[model samples]
Target: MAQVLPPLLDYEQSYPCPVCRQGQLDRLILMDAFSCNVCHHIFSVNLSQQSICLADRTPALGWRWARQRWRPLHHPDIDFPLGIWILCGGLTVLPPTILWVMHYIFPPLPDSSANSFPLLWIGVVGITHSLIALWILAEFYQLPLYLSWKFRLQS
Candidate 1:
């Protein structure tokens, strides 16, 4: 069976917000633009191209209206490649594993608290690296936390 592509949305209709994914994009009164109730983002609609772009940002963020959902439009300059994902994963896992292995291979002296394996430090390092990795990935992936701070600063 052949798949049919969704028709472009008319200016009168409401669609899901591409940025927040939680709000409906309602058309603004006396204007051709749309705004999301949740994110409060203004979007410029292009009927000819069948797309909506974030009106306030440079290097415009945009999405095309599919029948059931919005499809994100990609910009090469903003997209991170596979290498960055790999690096993030490494940053999340490598340091903790190395510390664990070192602790196991060179056991701390018994009855000497000062020569302990420093398990708290190991956990701290793991959590810190994991948070850094999560933050980087979230920013690139456009997660809610990153978007909140990003848009907050602009406002």
Candidate 2:
């Protein structure tokens, strides 16, 4: 006997796979779920007024696929561009070089220059540079995190 197959979704009716991000998502209509053709993962759709997430709680397999890799759900490794480190390195060195050159040209007298070049300047440079680095890293790492969480669903 030939097993009956359900209807397949068309291109427009399908969506990008939430897990692989590379496959098309086709509806498993009879089950009220969705399946990814590429990775063959299943999802339980949860639509609510406040929030809509696939899987809707702890995933059964406890794994997530993102950035072309599979990792543990809660602690997925984030993928970031190499450019973030390059930019951060330049920013880190430029400020200190400028400060050092200025200090070298005008040698602060040991006893009387504390007021002119206060310790507060050091604090300012440190805080500003750290803030920039932290912000860049945060921005670079966020996308991967979002992807991992979004695809965590398992039906």
Number of the top-ranking candidate, with TM-score as the measure: 1
Tens digits of per-residue lDDT, candidate 2, 4-112, equal 3223323224555545556766667676566788567776543221111356345453444332333444545654467788888777767866776777777678788
Candidate 1 per-residue lDDT, tens place, 1-155, comes to 94343466887677878887657888999999999998888999998877899998998988877666666778423444587789999998999999988988987888777675568778999999999998888866777777778778887
In model 1, the worst 10-residue window by lDDT is 72-81
Q: Could you tell me every candidate's TM-score relative to the true structure?
A: 0.63, 0.39
Error of 1 at 79 (Å): 12
**After superposing candidate 1, which stretches have Cα over 4 Å from the reference?**
1-6, 75-89, 101-114, 131-155
Clash number by candidate, in order: 0, 0
RMSD of 2: 12.7
